[model samples]
Target chain A: MTDTTQAAPASTRDRLLDTAAELFYRDGIGVGVEVLCRAAGVSKRSMYQLFGSKDEVVAASLERRLPASEAFLLPPADDDRPPRARILHVFERLEVMTAEADFRGCPFVAAAVEVKSPEHPASLVARRAKNALTAFFQGEAERGGARDAALLARQLTVVFDGCGARAVVQAQPLDGLAVVTAAALLDGAGMRS
Target chain B: MTDTTQAAPASTRDRLLDTAAELFYRDGIGVGVEVLCRAAGVSKRSMYQLFGSKDEVVAASLERRLPASEAFLLPPADDDRPPRARILHVFERLEVMTAEADFRGCPFVAAAVEVKSPEHPASLVARRAKNALTAFFQGEAERGGARDAALLARQLTVVFDGCGARAVVQAQPLDGLAVVTAAALLDGAGMRS
Candidate 1:
C-alpha cells in the first residue's frame, strides 16, 4: 500500500485550507463554519480543535497566499530592470495569473469586500496586505522619478484592482492586460524596448 | 387604519427587496433562501410565490438599483459640454456616490464576484449593464478622435471598476475619485474645465 494513509492529519489540514479557500473565494467569508467542515470532510469539532474558528482558517489561508503574491509583486533585489520595467513586469504577472482557467480575481480584494467589519481578524490581515502593496507601489514610483509618487502609486494600485475585476467580469484576460499596459504607458512608465 | 391595510402587498415587496439588497450586498448571494425569507419577514411560500427563486429576487433588487446607476452613467443630453466633458461627468457622479455614508462598492461588481457562473441571468444583466457602459465610453472616446476608441473604453471601464473597489475596501471615497481623474488624464481625455 502507498504511504498516503499515514499522513492523515497533515492531509486534513491541507484539505481544510483548500476547502476554506474555495468557499471564501467563491462564496465569500460569510459562509458558515459547519458548511466548511462538511465540505472539507472533517468534523466541526476537528475544525475548531485545529483552527479555533472560521476567522483563524481565513487568516491561515491568507497568510499562505500573501507570501506568494508578495514574491510576484515585489521586484527582486538583483533585478536590473528600470523602475518602469518592473512596474510593467507586475502587470505581466497579473496577466499570466488571470489567464488561468480558474482565476477568480484577487483573493485579498474579495476578502476585503466581504468582511464589512474592519475589526475582524481577516479584515485586519487583508488590510495589512493591501497597505503593503500600496507602500511597494509608492516606493517603486519614487524610484521611477514620478514627481508625485504618492499620487502615482495610488493610481497604479487602482489599475491593479481594476484589471483584476475586469478580467473576471469580462472573462477576457488579455483585454485586462492590455488596459493595464495602456494605463502604465499613459502614466509615463514608458514601454520597454 | 382604513387605507393603511390596503397598501400591504406593495409594502411587503418593497421590504423584501430592501432586505434582500442589504443581505445580498453584505452577506453575498449564497446566503440561504430561508435566511433571506426570515430576514425580510416573509414566509418561504410567499418568497417563492412572489419572486420564483432567490435568483429572481437578486435580479429584481439589482434592477431596482439599476435605473439610478444608468441615469448617472447615461445622463440626458447636455449641449452645454462637449462629449469628453460629458464622459468625465460620469466619473464625477460616481465620486459623489462613493462619498455617500452607506457606500459599499459597486453592487453589480460585488454581485458578479459572488455569482460564479457567467451565464446566470443576474450575471447576464450585470454584464449587459457593464457592456452598455463600455459602449457609452467608446462613443465618447470616438467623439474625441481617439486613435483606439475601443481600447480607451476598456481602459476607462477598468479605472471605474478599480476605483469603486478601492473606495469600498479602503473606506476612502476621495481616494477613488482621485485615481479615476488621474486615469482619465492618462487616457488623453483632457480635464474638464
Candidate 2:
C-alpha cells in the first residue's frame, strides 16, 4: 500500500523493519537473513545496502519497536492518573497481551535471551528498553513518595518480566495475577494513590 | 568422560543428553543437528536411533536436567529450614546462578520462549520444570500458613523468574534484589518463618 516511488529507500527500510520485528518475535532470533529478506519482500542486495548485517537488522527492529511498545504499556502523556494506577496500568496491559494465543513473551527480553550474548547489539537495545520501563517506574515512585524509588522500580520491572515468562511457560491466562502482584508491591512500598 | 565400552547405548545416550543440554543452553534451540552431533561426538544416524527426532532430543535433554536443575536451585533434601527459609533458598541460589558469566536466564524459560510454541515437546518439558518450582513454593507456602498459599507460591515463582530476567537483560549481578523482593512478598502475604 505504500507509494514506493516516494522516498523509496525509507519506505523499504520501514517494510524491512516491520517484517523483522514480526518474524523475530514469532520465530526467535535465529531467523536467517535470507529468510528475513524473502519474507520482507525486500531484495537481499537492498537489505544489505540498508543494514550492515543481520545483527543490525535485529537491533534496529527492536529499537524501532521501543516507542510503540512503551506507548502500549505506559499510560497516556496527558492523563493524570495516580502513580500507583499508572504503574498498575502496565501490568493490566500485559495481562491482556498474555491472553492472546500468539503472545510469546516480551520481544525485547526474548531477543536478549535468545542471543545469549549480553554484549550483542540486540541485547543492548533490549537493555535500554527495559531500563526505560524501570526509569518510568522510578519517576512515578518518586512522585508518589515511595520509600526506595529505585528499588521499587526495579522490583516492578522484575514482576513485569516475570509475569511475561510465566505466561509463556504456562501458556495460561494470568487472570488477575499480574495486577494483583503489582498492587501488592505498591502497597508494600506504601505507595497509596 | 563416559566409558563407551560398557553399555554403549546408555553411554551414548548420556553423552548426547549432556552435550545437548549444554549446547542448547549456551546456544539457542536453533543449533543445527549436525553441529549438535558433532559437538557431542554423535553421528547423525546414531542420534536418530537414540531419539526419534531433534525435538525429542531437546525434550529429553531438558528431562535429563530436571533432577540436577532442581537440586541446584532448591534446598537440600535434608534441609530442616523453616518454610520461609526454604522458599527464599531458591532465590538465593538464583542470585548466585545469575552472577555466572554464562547465565542466560532459566533454561526452561529460555526454552519455552525460544520455541514460541507451548505444545512443543521441549516447551512441555519447560512447563513441567517451571511447575515443579511452583509446586515446591506452594508446599512451603502451605506449611508456612500463608493466607493464600497458591497465590503466594505463584508470586514467588514470578519473583524468581523476574530476577532471572533482570540479571540476564542487565547483565549485572542481582546483589540481593531477588532475596529482598521475595522477602517483601513474603511479608506482604504474612508468611512468617
Q: Which candidate should be chosen as best, given lDDT against the real structure?
A: 2
Taking the candidates in order, what DockQ does each have? Answer: 0.49, 0.89
Interface RMSDs of the predictions, in order, are 2.3, 0.6
Off by over 4 Å in 2: A1-6, B1-6
* Model 2 CA lDDT for position B54: 94
Q: Rate residue A42 of model 2 by lDDT.
A: 97
Candidate 1 lDDT (Cα, 0 to 1): 0.73
Native contact share for candidate 2: 0.90
Q: Candidate 2: DockQ?
A: 0.89
Candidate 1 lDDT score at position B1: 81
lDDT of model 2, residue A10: 93
TM-score of 1: 0.85
Top-TM-score candidate index: 2
In Å, residue B89's CA in model 2 sits off its true spot by: 0.9
